[model samples]
Target: MRASHAYFLFVGTLLTAAGYGATFLLTEHFRALGGSEIDTSTTLGGAMAGTLIGVPLVGWYAKKLKAARMGAMGAVSVAAGYGFLALLTTLTPLIALAGFLIGLGWGIFYLAGPMALSERVTDQDRGFWFTRFGAFQMAGIGFSPIVAAALVEHLGLSTRGAFGVIAGATLVAAVLLLTFEALSPQASQARAQTSNWMRALPALLSSRAIYPILMVGLGACVFSGMLTFQSSLVRGTGLEAGTFFAAYAVTVVVARFVLAPMINRADGDRASVVLLALMILGVVTAFGLVYGVPVQIASAILLGLGYGLVYTVIQTQAVNDAPPEHRSAALTWFVIAYFFGIFGFPVLGGWLIVTVGIAGFLAAVLAFAVAEMALALLRGRQTTRKPVSA
Candidate 1:
């Protein structure tokens, strides 16, 4: 691999891990401030909703400036948002304001980095590269919770202190991102010249690559519902709500590093089908968690494995067919789809938990997984019929 690719990948991992830490700290910090479970879920959902607002902005900015510049702005926003979070003791509007900045930074980092990485690899290698990227990206997601939890426990720091730590990490990630020469001079000029936002949308919307990508996004919706509310689902199982998130994060880490590599090494279509099936199983395991802790951990592990593979496959397939100039647009649109799922599902999960309880919430999430499984199957068959070169 090229030095720039390695650097971009490292920066992406650091950013992802920091983002994961901030996400955990925010949930715990809000709750510590006497926010209700419903309120906490809503705030998290709303913060994610802010990303929906920011993605189009990043997509637009990518047209005019180098992605590195946007990424730097994103990192600064992440640190400033977390710094603001550290200063506030009350359940103030600052939390919400900070959320918007956090969302914007996340969108820019995600949109810019992957596309830059993809540019360096060939079509036949895109799947492998995306999996490697996801693996590294998820390494951050998997490990940050343990580190953050240790920070909170060992330092006797306030939740805001933890938030500050996350902020510092994000700033370092942003600085690292800014130093890398990931974008080619020619590619940078191409992005700078293509300034019209509307023009990019049509081709993204028209691609044959969209079906499987849609499945990835929708599958993520299922994962979001579980993440936002699984604590509530695991509540009556004699495990503390805090333990649920810890377990969830740990399982996610293991699956990304362990199970995902083996699955990705297999055929992509067959592996995806298996992963979605595992997801359906995970959703079901969640329903069983209402009964006990063993089942809850099982649910976490299953879902983690399922989540680890689904996007890796979808992302691998999404960029495999697109030409280099169009690859950024393709990845941007795929992210738009992923963000839609991330944005929509939590609010719905909160409502479901409030209204139907754990069974109702898992049932609804299961439906999403089942639908995704069906889509993966159909897409697999169709892809086979056409014999895509990649």
Candidate 2:
């Protein structure tokens, strides 16, 4: 890789870490300001919304702004969002505004940074590079709670103080991202052209692409549910809620570091079967957690492995199958499947939890996993009958 590209990767890693840390830290800080559960949920919802909506907008405007400029703006928003929170004593209403701004900033950074990475790396290196990107992200997120725990314990810091730390980290990340050279105007325009929504949608919805999207959407449902309710699920286990996050994070990091490459190399059919089967096992194990801690930890590890591999495989397929011109939109839609899962799964899980207690939630997750596996098998048959050039 070029030195400039390497710089982008380094900075990209930093920016990802900062963005995630801000999410974890700021949520805790927001609670300190008398923010409600509703506020927290909305904030996360807004961030997801921003990412879903912002990718398309960013795709449209890639020609107008350099990645560095976008990175700076994103960082500034993180700072301003957290800064606003610091000023508020109670933030129920204003929390939405904060969510919007923070989400927008986070969304911009999320989309632009990866696009830049994809631009810099060669085709042969794309999977490996993106895996590394995922690793840094996993590390950043995994490390955040530890950092937050330490800051709170050692520094006698308030929740707002932690936000300051998160904000500062993002600001530094933004600066690092800015040091990379800008893509030429022509190159930017070309990428934008490739991502044009008008031309891309129909092609993407073609019969060949539809099955992959379905498979991805199914996997995303499992993932989305976990992100939304894993904390709550851990809390439900009657273990110290505080410790659950630590265990979950550690398990995720282990899965990402150890299994991602192997999963990435698997054929789509083999990967699909394995991924969903693992997810089913994970949820079943998580259900067993209500009975013991060992089960809970096992569930966490299984879910982490299942999710980590499924995401990598689905994402790889999304990019590999799409025409070059539609690559960006393809990714955007691929992520949309993920966001839909994030948005929808929690609500369903919430209802299930109410109806069947903890077991209901696990049952629902297992059901989704099984159904996804079934769909994957059907698609596998189709893929066998009519192979596409990958």
Q: Name the runs in model 2 displaced over 4 angstroms.
A: 1-8, 21-36, 182-194, 236-258, 323-325, 343-364, 385-390
- Candidate 2: residue 95 lDDT (0-100): 67
lDDT of 2 at 385: 32
What does the lDDT read for residue 220 in candidate 1? 70
- Total clashes for model 1: 0
Residue-level lDDT of model 2, residues 98-183, one tens digit each, is 66667667666666666666666666786666666776666665566567657776899776676667777777777666665443
The worst-scoring run of ten residues by lDDT in candidate 1 lies at 186-195
Q: Which stretches of candidate 1 lie over 4 Å from their true place?
A: 1-12, 120-129, 182-208, 240-268, 290-293, 320-328, 381-390
Query: Model 2: how large is the Cα RMSD against the reference?
Result: 3.8
Q: Which candidate is the best by lDDT?
A: 1
lDDT of 1 at 135: 57
Q: Give the total clashing residue pairs for model 2.
A: 1
lDDT of 1 by residue, 108-192 (tens): 6676666555555566776556655665566565456556667777888877887888888888887666665444332422333
